[model samples]
Target chain A: MAYQRKRICRFCEAGVQYIDYRDEKRVSRFLTERGKIIPRRVSGTCAKHQRMLSSAIKRARILSLLPFVSDNPA
Target chain B: MSELRNYEVTFIAEPNFDDERVNSLVGKYTEFIEKNGGTVEKVERMGKKRLAYAIEKRQYGYYIYTEVKMPGEAVAPLKRWFALSEDVFRHLAVRMTDRDVRLKAVTTEHYRKEMDRRNAATRPGAREGGFREGGREFREGGRPERRDD
Candidate 1:
């Protein structure tokens, strides 16, 4: 197997215990250009933080703080 | 019966509402919470802001968040009020769990530190616009290739 560097969870490194849905700017970083949630493997988020991040994204979408689907799929 | 628990209620009201109207609506909701065996701990008007997408054809909304302590029964009625009211376009009520309280403190501190770091690192012209920061990839899609048949 080829050697690969292990990726660390951004939230864990930052000591982020809670992912606030109101912080759309930060949450958007984990979304794709089409506004879909990036998979845990790709984002390098641990399972626990990934769960919290997904729920937070959903809540933000409900509040229209983040788009459900991007109009400009860049 | 479930004991009184703390909940954070957030709602988006019509952006066109005047300051007086907004204040009255806040008063009305606080009164309703009190009547339904809830105590209003705090009410914050987040003010008019743009929505990520149009809701009911409105591009902007006035956000109001309230922290309330109430019995479980009060949540249903509050939801019903939001659904029936024309003034409110959207609403969310979340019961604050023990973990949530702890996370709140942790996240707040982290956020403050993150902000300080960001401010220190940021320079003029570092960010061009709001659009690019959200997505990592940018591709030019101005024209599509056409094949003649």
Candidate 2:
């Protein structure tokens, strides 16, 4: 098997206890260019943190803090 | 008296309002929360910014966040009031409880320690591993490609 780089969960590493929906900048990093939430595998977020992140993203989207979908021309 | 609990509400306001009117709007909501038997802890005005998408044909929105302490039962009525309001576009109220507060403080710590233990038991440099969806290699077209011409 090819030697894959170790990918630690950034939130885990940074000790992110709670995912706040108001910080759009921090939330934006977890989203793709198309405004989709990056999965756990790609984002390297722990299961718990991933769950928290997804909910926060959804909540932010509802409050218009984040986009449901991107406006860019695909 | 009903036991007071914590809640954090965020609302989106119309961007067309002047600063004075916006301040008034915030004041009105704060008063509403107070009248609902809640003590407003802090009100954060996030200011106007471009919405990720247009809401009601407007490309921008104003945001205000309020943290308050009130009885759990009072939340529904306040939310209902927000829904009926004309100026507010969207609002979200998250009830904070003691259990949630404790969990937020400890989940990260426990998660970190668990990760450490798991990593220690693995191969010299094996990662804890992650899930990857090996989805379909070929794309399926909903409509026949090129109408099969």
**Candidate 1 chain B weakest ten by summed lDDT:** B139-148
RMSD of each: 11.2, 14.4
Runs in model 1 with CA error above 4 Å? A1-6, B114-149
lDDT of 1 by residue, A21-51 (tens): 8888989999998899999877789999999
lDDT of each: 0.85, 0.77
Evaluate model 2: give its lDDT.
0.77
B29-99: candidate 2 lDDT, tens digit per residue: 88887888888898888888788778889888888888889888888888898889888888899877787
Q: Which pairs clash in model 1? A: none
Residue pairs that clash (backbone atoms under 3 angstroms), model 2: none
Cα misplacement distance, residue A20 of candidate 2 (Å): 1.2
> How many angstroms is residue A22 displaced in model 1 relative to the true structure, after the best TM-score fit?
0.9
Residues B15-37, candidate 1: write the lDDT tens digits: 99999999999999999998998
Candidate 2: where are CA atoms >4 Å away?
A1-3, A71-74, B99-149
DockQ of 1: 0.58
Q: Pick the candidate with the highest TM-score.
A: 1
